[model samples]
Target: MKSGTVSQDYDKNETDGKVGLKRRLGFFDSLSFLVGTIIGAGIFVSPKGVLEYSQLNIGVALCIWAACGVICILCTLCYAELGSSLPFAGGEYYHVRRGLGPIPAFITIWTLTLFIRPSSNAARALTFAEYVSRPFYSGCPPPELLKKSLAIGILLTLGVINSKSIKLATWVQNIFTILKMMALTLIIVYGFIEFATNPDASKPFQDAFNSQFPNAAQTAEAFFQGLYAYGGWNFLNYMAEEIKNPSKNIPRSVITAMCAVIVFYLLVNISYLTVLTPRELISSAAVSVTWADRMIPSWAWIIPVSVAISIFGSLNGGMFMLGRLNYAGSKEGHLPSLISMLHVRHLTPAPAMIISTLIACIFVIPSDLVSLTNYFSFSSWLLVGLTCVSLIVLRFREPNLERPYKVFLPLAFVVVGVSAFLVLAPIIQSPKVQYFYALLFMFSSIIIYIPFVHFKLKIPYFNKITCYLQLLLEVSPTDMFEDSKTE
Candidate 1:
C-alpha cells in the first residue's frame, strides 16, 4: 500500500474536536531549520578531524567534505520528495511507518525519540553553553552545574518560544539563521583577504597535495569521519506540516541549504588554514577564534560573540524540529499520546519538547562537545542508513503515490546511500551503540504491532526489559502504542 493510502485510524475513539496542525513556517524558515541544525559544533570541531585526515591539505579536505555534502544532499532529495508527498511532522518516523509495517516504523521512531534526536539537541546545547562561556574564562572551566544550567536554560527558552506561536518560532529561526550565515560570510571574506597579504599564510597548494596520511586506510577512515560532521542536512524535512507549500519549499530549502553549508564550510576552512598553520590549526581547540583574531584585526571583539550566536541559532533549530518527530509519531498512534497533544495556545507539542529537552540537558552535563558529536554521528548515521533503505522499500511497495520532488536520478541516491553506510560502519565500533540501535528497533516493533494494534502478537523479554528501562530513565514512551482516547 502506498503511504498516502495508509489508514489513519488505529483503534481510536476520536469523533470530535479533531483539528489539523497550524502551518506557519515559510521557505526562509525552512531553509534556516536545515542549515542551523547542520552548522553547529561540526564546523567548530570537525576541522581537527578533517585536518588530521587530510594531513593539513585544507583544499583536499574540503573536497572530501563537499563530497559528503553531495551525499547528504541526495539524501535530502529523497526526504524532500517523501516529506512533501506526506507533508507531516514526524519526519522519518511517519514515512518509514507508512512505507513499512507498523512494527518496523515503531523501531525507527524508537531510535529517534530515545537516542538520536535528543542526543543531538543536547550536544548542540552543550556546545552553545561552552561557546557562550568561553569568552572570559580560560583553562578547564567551572563545574557541571554552570554548563548544565545554561544548557537547560537555552532549552527552556526555545521550548517556550516554540510553544507560544509557530510564526514567532519561525521568525526567530529566520533571524538567527541569517545572523549565522552573515557571520560566516564575514569571517570567510576577511580571512581570505588576510591570507592574500600575509607572508606566513598557508603553504602553496602543491605542498598540501603532496602531503599524505600515514596510510591509505587511515586517509579513507579520516574522510569518513569528516563525513559525520555534515549530518544534519535533512533535519528540516521533519517539519513538513508546519512549512508553507511543502511541495514547492521542501525541495528548494533542502537543495539551497546543502549548497549554502558546503560553501560556508569550504570558505571557513580555507580562511582558517590561511590564518593558522596546519599544525597550529590542529593543535588549538579554538580554531575559529584563532582565525578571527588573525583576520579581523579590528573586530576581534565580535568574533566570540559571533560564534556564540551561531551555536545558539543551531541549538534553536535542532530543538524546534526534534519535537516534531515525537509529535508525528504520537499522531500516528505509534508514540505516547502526550507527545501529540499540542498546547492549544502555542500550537506546539509542549510535552514532547519538554521531555526531549530534558533528555538532551541530562546527556550534555558530562561529555565534551566533540565526543558527544562523535556519538551522535555514529548512531545517527546508522539509523540514516535504515531510513535510506526504507525509502527504497516504500518506492517499490507504493510506486503510485504522488511525489512532488521525484528523483529521476535514483542511481545517485542508491550509490550515496550505500556510501553513507560504508562511511558509518567503522564508527559503530562500540558494542553498546550497536546493541542500542538493535534493541531500540525491536522494542518499537512490539509496541506498534501488539497490544496497541489489538493483535495477538507476543513480545520478547529483551524488548520488555528495554521498554521498562527506558521508562525508568524517563525517556519519552516509544510507539504511540495506545489509542488517543480517555480511558
Candidate 2:
C-alpha cells in the first residue's frame, strides 16, 4: 500500500490562520547551519580514535579521512534530490516515510529522539565544558559536578537562543562558522610553513603506509570516527522548508559546505603531523590543543577558547534542526501533537526544543557519552543506509514527481553500499557486545510502535493535557511550511 504525508497539504495550510516558520534563511544561513553542525568538537578534541585505529599509519589515516568526506558528499547528493523534490522539514524521517512507509519512519525517529540526537548533543556540550573548565584546573581534571553543570548550561543557552529568535540564531551561527574556518585556516597555514622548514615533518609521511595493518574491524571503527568528524552534512536538508528557494539553496549550501570542510580537514590533519609525531598525535587527549602548544606555546590558551565557541555554534544548529524533526513527526501524527506547535509570537518550535533540551540534560550526566558515539554508530549507519535506499525507491515510485535538482542515480547506490559496509563490517569481522545491544534496542522500539502508533491507541485526557501545556508554553499548533517547490 502507498503511504502519504501531510507535507502535501502544506500549501493549503499556509493560507490558514495558524502561524508557521518563516523563510528568513537564505543561502548563507543554510550554509552556516551545515558547517556549524559539522565543524564541532570532533575535530578539536577527538580524531585520535581515527589515528589510533588506523594503526598509526599516516597514509591510511589520511585516506580514511578523504574517503569519509567523499562518502558524505555522495550521501548529500541523494539528500539534494530529495530536498529539491520534497522540500520538507524532518529530513530523513520525511524522506523515509514518503518512500518506505510510516512504520519505518516512526521507528527511525523514535531511536533518534530517544537516544541518538540527545546523546550526541550532550557529548558536544560536555566537550565544550571540558575546554572551558581546563583553565580553572590546570594540572588535574575538573570536578564531575562542574563539568556536568557546564554541559547542562550549554544545552539551556542554545535551546533558549533557538527558541528566542531565528534571526539571532542565524546571526550567531554565521559568526561562529567564519571563526571556525579562520581557526582551521590559521592552523593550515602554520602547518604548511612548519612542514616546509622543519625536516622532521617529512618523517611521518616517509613510511606512512608501512605502519602495522589494522584488522577489518579496526578499519571500520576508524572510518566511523572519521565520519563522526564529518557529521551534519545533511543538516541543511532538515530545514528545507525554512530555507529560501530551497531547490537552489539546498544544493548550493550542501556542496559549498562539503568542499570547504573537506579541504580544511585534510590540511588540518596534515598540520597535526608536522608538529606531533604519529605516537604523540594518537596519545594526546585534545588534538588541536597539543598542536597549538607545539606551534605557539605562548598562545596555547586560544585554541581551547576558539574550540568552545565552535562547539557553541554546533550545539545551536543541532537543536535548531531537532525541533523541526519533532515538529514534522508530530504533524504526521507519529508524536504528540504538542511537539508540532510553534510559539505564538516567535513562530518557533519552542516546545519541541525545550523537550529535547530536557532530554539532553539527562544525557549530560554520563561522562562516557563520547565513547558511546562509536557504539551508536552501528544504528546510525543502518538508518542512513535505509534512507539511501529510500532515495532509489522514490526515484522509481515517483518518476513523475518534479525534481529541480536530480543527481546521478548511481551516486545513491554508492552511499547505500558504503553505509552497508559501515554497518556490517564490524559485526562480520569483530563483533562487539555493543553491536548486539544496539540491534536489540533498535528492534525493541517496535514495542512502543505497536501499542501507540500502529494501533492508533489514544491516551485518556491527552487532549486536555495538550491544551493545558499549549497555554502554559504560549504556543499554538502551526502549519509546517510553504510549498517551496520550484520548477
Candidate 3:
C-alpha cells in the first residue's frame, strides 16, 4: 500500500503551484454552517419514529438523543483535530486519504457522491415539500407530482444560490438558522409555560421510565433516528479550506455548535413530551406541527413554514459542502477533472454544484424516506468509523506532525467504538438486504477505481468530449481547466 503524510501532500501542492479555494468563511460563517446544516427537518419529522421505535418511552428516547449528542461531540473533536491539521476541502475523504490510502479515500467519496449525499439531499427536499404542502392538503396527502416538483424546484434554487456566491449562501444559512432556532425557542417556551401552569400536562413525565423496553433492533433503529438529526455537525469540516483561521475556528465552531444543538434538542424533546403524551408523540406524523396546533393554534401555520425554511437552509449547506467535496475529489483526480474547476466570477465549484444537484433531483424520484434514512445512516456511520480510526493511525504514523488541535487518545477510542456500534448494531439486531446493498455500493467504488484511478485509464478523445460538453453547459473554459493531481 502507498503511504504518505499530509505534510508531504502539502509540499507537493506547493511544488505543483496550484491555485486553491479562496478562504472567505470566518468563525461565525463556519458556526452557521455547522448549526444550520444540522437543524434540518429531521428534528421535526424523526422524533415520531424515535419515540415509536423506543416503545414510546420518553426516558429512553431522550436518553438516546443525549447519548447520540455526546457521541457526536466526541466525533466532532476527532474531526476538529483532522480539519485543523489538514485544513482541506474534502473533509472526511481528505482525512482518510492522507491517513489511510488513495483507494480508501476514493471508496469514501464514491459512496458519498453517488449515494449518501444525494439521498440525504433528496430526503430533506422531500420533507421540505411535505411540510410546505401540509397546510394545503385538505384530505389525502399532496399529489406526488407536486411534491416532486417542489423538491426539484428547491434543489435547483439552492443549487443556483450556492453556485453563484458562497457569501450569499452563508447569508441564507445564517438567517434561516436563526429563524429555525426561534421556532424551537417558541416550542420550548410554550412547553415550559404549559408544564408550569397545567398540572395535567405534566403526566407524560410522571411515568416516563415506566414503559416497556424495546428490543435490540428497535433500540438500534431509535438511536439511528436520533443520530440522523445530529448528522450535519461535521459539515463545516468539508469546507475547512475556506474557513478563516481554520485551526482556531474549526474546533471552536464544532464545540459551540454541538453544545448548542444538544441543549436545543433536549429542550425540544422535553417540550414535546410536556405538551403531548408519549402516545400522542408516537402517533403524530409531524410532532412539531402537532405541538404547535395544540399549544398555539392561532399561529400553527408558523411551524411548517419554519420547517420549510430550516430544510431549505440545510439543503443550501449540504449543496455547498457537497460541491466542495466534489472539487476536492476532482483536484486529486479521483473524479472527472472538470468538476475541480472553480468559477472565475463566483469562485465557486459550479460544475460540482450542478452535478450534485442533478443527482439529488434524480434521487427525488424514489420517495422511500425510511429506506433512504437507513441506507444513509448505515453507510455514513461506517465511513465515520473508518475516518475516526484513521485519526489514530495518523497519530502513530506521523508523531511529530503539527496538530493545531488534538483529540485525546481515549476520547478518540470512544468515538471509534461508538461508531462501530452505530454501524453494526442494526445489522446485528435485524439483518436487512438493504445493508448488503449499501455494502455492495461501497465496494463497487473499487471496481471503478481500478480502471480509472489505479490504471489511469482514459477514453479516446476524452478532453474533446469534455470540451464540447463544457461549451454546451456554458462553463467558462478558463474556469474548467486546471492542472489536476492525484494524491
Number of the top lDDT candidate? 2
Q: Identify the runs in model 2 with alpha carbons over 4 angstroms from their true place.
A: 1-18, 210-215, 368-373, 480-487
lDDT agreement with native, every candidate: 0.68, 0.84, 0.83
- How many pairs collide in each candidate, listed in order? 4, 0, 0
Any runs in candidate 1 off by more than 4 Å, and if so which? 1-18, 199-202, 213-216, 365-376, 412-420, 427-487
lDDT of 1 by residue, 1-487 (tens): 2334321332121233344455567787788878877776667655877777777666677677788788777778777777776676777777666666566667777767766677777767766787777655777785567777888799878877776667777777778778778888887887778777876664654366766644565566666666666767768767877676777888899999899888888888887777777888888777777776666657876766777787787778878777888787767766655566665444567766777777776776667532544444444655565566667776787687666777755753674466575645554533356445445554656655567554534456745764564454343332332222211
Predicted structure 2, TM vs. truth: 0.93
TM-score, cand. 3 vs. native: 0.92
Best by TM-score: 2
- Number of the candidate with higher lDDT, 2 or 3: 2
Residue 219 in candidate 3, Cα distance off native in Å: 2.7
Q: How accurate is candidate 2 locally (lDDT)?
A: 0.84
lDDT per residue for candidate 3 within 300-412, as digits (tens), equals 88988988988988888999999999988887779988787766666677888999999999989877743565655767877888888889998998777678898888888
